[model samples]
Target: MLRFFFSFLFVQIFLCQTSIAQTDWSKQLDHYISKRDEIDAVKKKTIKNLLKDLQSTREEKNRDKEFIALMQSVKAYEYFVYDSAFKYAQSANRLAYQLNDKSKIAESKSKLSLIMLLKGLYTSSIDTLNTVEYQYLSNEKRKEFYSTAYRAYYDLSGYSRDKHYSEAYKKLGHFYSQKLIDEFKEPSFEKLLGLALQSMVTGKLNQAEDYYIELLNQFNLNNHETAIVTSGLGFIYSDKGEVEKAKEYLMQASIADIKSSTKETTACRSLAEIFYKEVEIEKAYQYILLAKADADFYGSEQRKFEISYILPLIESARFRKENKQKKMFGLIGVLVLVFSLVILRQLQKLRQARKEIVRSNQNLIHVNEMLREASQIKEEYIGYYFNFSSQYIDKLEDFKKSISRQLITKSYDNIEQELKKYNSKKERQRLFEDFDRIFLKLFPDFVQRFNQLFDEKDRIRLKDELSLNTDLRIFALIRIGVNDSEKIAGILNLSVNTIYTYKTKIRNRSIYPNEEFDLKVMAIKSV
Candidate 1:
């Protein structure tokens, strides 16, 4: 059914082109409104009286009165509202049929067909035109019949793309266009409009511009003529690549359409496409929506399809913009989370380190107290040992004096007996015993502590528990910061070679290396 409709439309277009010139006046919607407003203002009084007379005639219910009223109504609304115009035209047809007025029927049907074409129902327009019997039409009505047919085909040609149909429609439109020209003898507004359309359809843009501009200058164009002229200029400037001028003219046409209450227009759609191509997205979207609303209101399927192409492109661009923003926000959120985690982990580690430092400070404070007590003990022991040594020296001095007096008295037996009683080994033994007692008092657990540094087999076992062995005495001297081997040997009453041998043997048996043995021994706990 759709194919048949389009095919019929194309055929009518071809036929109409064979007899007329095709002009796309839809572009000049603004020019039409500007012209229509002027015409309506001038005809306002006449239209008002006609409407009053029609209402009275309707109330009277007389055949002649009714017939005249219906015709008047059709004529009055022809430029105001197409649907109202069509409705009145149909009323005229019905009245003429009842009155058996064939001429009136033909005129009414012709008017109806033209309105149908304006509504974009090409097949219906052609069918309406076919219903009008040509023989019954008046000479003026016959001319109107051809003129309306020419307009219908002209409009159809604009929407058709088939090369064969396009060419045929163009030729037919030119033929009828010339015939219409023959009907005009002078340079009137209608003639001028027809001439401009003819020139434009034939691609003679300069001629069309001259005619249209001349018409606009000379006469106040009606809504339809203004639409035709301005839209033609817009097309011409667009072809010349004068984008601003073209847009200006198209905008003017659109404004005219708005003021004139004309919904069937191409200017808004054209402007939308231009803005879209120029990447003016917001303007494109605004214009496209307007165009779509107008197209839907106008009820033209072709215009609806044309608008459909641009809507999706703009919507997709909007969606992509929104989607990109969402992704960017998501990435920012992820980055913030990762950064927060990094700071949290650093804070945790810092807290743990602070705890460890506080614990270490507490342990250091306890160790410092132990060292202070040990220092005081060492000082008191040293003072006691020095006092005891001083008293023992005084007693030895008195004993020496007694022995000397006995020897001088010439008693060889007494001197020999005193000398035998005071043996050198026995005196040395008493001195060592006193030293051990003072040393042991200072460090009671010295033997146990010293032996802990070596393996069981390498440990020094003293036969006398009261006295330290040679090696123990050497390290003990080292623990007291007395590391000199000669000083140690003199204090222990041993040879320097024996002291050295004892030091080397103990060091070899120690868990610590040779070089670090003395340091390790010094590091032993004082208590």
Candidate 2:
């Protein structure tokens, strides 16, 4: 009887352990199921933690590698909270690649690219995506990659102020837009859209509407699509200064029953902009309230803050308008009171409104002036800086030997001592400016040539500087036309490697497979 009890106890112990293991496995699977709900933030988090625990178990069992990748995706989705999500996603992506699980890898890559994009790391995003695009397996995946690349290019173009990059992004956007539209058995509709959007972005406003109308027709099939197309058209009309047409599309967009908070918020904002521009104050205010409601639903801090900043300004403008109207009404009661007193009061109030209007008009004028001044200043600086630099750089060799002789046994400290002899700040400033003008005129191509001498990264850093190192600037002058590196270096009071290093950095920054990207030629010549 005792031996029988012992056997039963052993069997019970073994069964309990097996049951616990099975329960844990089931719980992990449940976590993944919830995580698959892309919109559920809480589920995303729960899945992510569960995934970390599952990783060790997966390795121990030497099984379910795809499951491990799914967990990695769950963690990556939560990257909006922690920056490490990018790193974790990358690791999982590499593992997926090793496992030949291309699908999960693509998902991981897309997620990673988006994270980089949101963080404003456009260059890194582009670089990361370049590798991932090759792994795209489906048309959907290819469409996604192209879209991401297009957006990344747009962001990069904005930062660099490069029109070439902007055009490239526009082209890519059209490509992806076409891909998405074509996949729906509406090739003409998509083609129309491509032309419209491309034209709108490129400022060909006259041709955009027909496509917008066609896109709007799709709204019958998908009301949400209709809303988006109309809203886009409204904005385009707004850009063209056609306030009435803009309002029509904006109102249409606002009427859509959208589950997407972002879509609803955008439509509301569009409506508000139209109302504001049309001077429909009450309608504008109402639209803003509606926009706020949608913005709150979306949980986007950027949208909330943008609205917050605009709200007070909007309210103040409305208040002033209302009070000004009341003051106008007050003027009508002029005949009832004692004439002089009434006249005085009217004058005071009229004076106040006029003052307010004047102040507002003055502010507008000031803002316009500032804008004009800023534009003029920028154009003048770029034109003069580059043009003058080219001219000065041309004459670098004329004074290179003279400057080099003076500098052979000298130091920067000695130059500063000479600068100190100028007794007044004004004199010093004048002297510095004069020297700059002369030095730059002599080596006008110095900045470009100097930049040409750097690696790509260094060139980017240097191109941003309005002025460069004096000695290097001098060397750039010598290098502009003088091909001998050693002669140029000694003439500019620099070592041979200093000249060589400059040349090397410039080469690195240049378009690949080419060297001696002549700074003088590039700076002075236009393509």
Candidate 3:
């Protein structure tokens, strides 16, 4: 019973270990997908450094070092750039031939075959593979040779689309896949990949998924490995009708392929077909275009031919969707245009209303200014009138008293002399002085400002600061809005003809044009 318990414990332990080995790495896969661009950049920088090392090895003139460098360059560029990888592989093959190294020749030919397969030259790839001597290749090179041969036959089978030829090609592919699996003594990435591919081809989807998942868990995969494993899972899920899981895996695979700069990939094309079936036209069109671009970049004629079949269907659907959206947008645009015109018209009306309000405010301000000026004039003239009237009354009373005294003394000559004592010219001169003082009091800067309108040489020079010249007085009245020549003539006690002559003479001497001179005068601000 104790021995039975030990055996049972051993079996349980072995199953537990197997289960642990197949643990899910979904989170790590997500992390790699998210950091695709960053990872791609690092890989590209590594390739750049490797290329520099290749140049240094060539310059050293060491054939062995040169061969190693060329092979390293081929490995570095294998996933990133197929053309460059092919060129390096060819160079390595030539160097190996020149060195007469059979092992190196077989390794270089295996690399060339893989690159040719990626480039859609399937027959050429198979021909190149046939030239490689399996006996001369090392264990690792033999595994690589079998892997490339399996992929070339598999791809050719798909490309042929003929029942007889496809079956024959598929049989050859299975043979190579079995050989690749036989190369490994234990589970490895390549071995597991080969097993998964074999199961997938033999319609053992459950077994294939198990193998791919185990590969994912067993290795810390680079971008290239991640893409291959995820792509296999995607195909398995798709075949099992688990569409959502298929899409998720395919998306991850596509991201991984992009990160590795692997352009010879079918993930995008598969995704395009899935999305197209779901009637997701935009996504289908987008992925189809990306597939076409990758095919073109990788120079894959087979991939291009495959894309050509589905591209037009997705493009037609997308064109119809776009036309429908354009019609809807056109209607919306017309509504927006009408709304804008209405808003613009309302804006114009608002501006006009604002302008009218501004003009009304200006008119009210002008009226208020006129009222203030009129009030000032009335107050000043009324005070002057009272003083003048009082003086005249006092002078008349004194004259009457003097005449009476002369008459009472019977002196007629003395009375006549008293009447003659009053000088009219002197009174008129005093009245003129009062008028000048009052006008100057109303507009203190009137003389200086009025002179500024004329040329410097023609400007009026005042005899005294308190008085204005004839020209100054004429426009000063106009500045106060007494625009009539007749009214100005009456106020200054001069003839209308004299007023006109003074106005014309000053205007002609002014710096401004005749038409604009009055407007400029009016533009002068008041205190």
Q: lDDT of each model, Cα atoms only? A: 0.69, 0.56, 0.78
User: Could you give the candidate ranking by TM-score, starting with the highest?
Assistant: 3, 1, 2
Using lDDT, rank the candidates from best to worst. Answer: 3, 1, 2
Model 3: residues with Cα > 4 Å off, grouped in runs: 1-42, 330-527
TM-score of each: 0.49, 0.43, 0.55
| Tens-digit lDDT string for candidate 1 (1-527) | 99999999999988566533212332343355446556446556676788788888888888777777877776665645555566667677767777888887787788888777776667667667767776687656666776776666666676667777776766666665666678656556655666676677778888988987898899887765676667778888887787766777777766665655456677778877776776667666777787787667656655665666667676555445545655565566567886655555555665576566556546655665566587678667777778877887887897788778887787788878877776778767776776676566667787787778778887778888898655676777776645446777888788989998988878888987764565456546545
Better of 1 and 3 by lDDT: 3
Best by TM-score: 3
Model 1 ranges off by over 4 Å: 1-55, 62-85, 130-146, 318-527
Model 2, runs deviating above 4 Å: 1-100, 111-128, 151-195, 218-224, 257-259, 263-265, 292-313, 325-527
- Model 3 lDDT per residue over 334-420, tens place: 789866555555556655765665566466556656755865775667589689979999999999998999999999999888878
- Of 2 and 3, the candidate ahead on lDDT is 3
Residue pairs with colliding backbones in model 3 are none
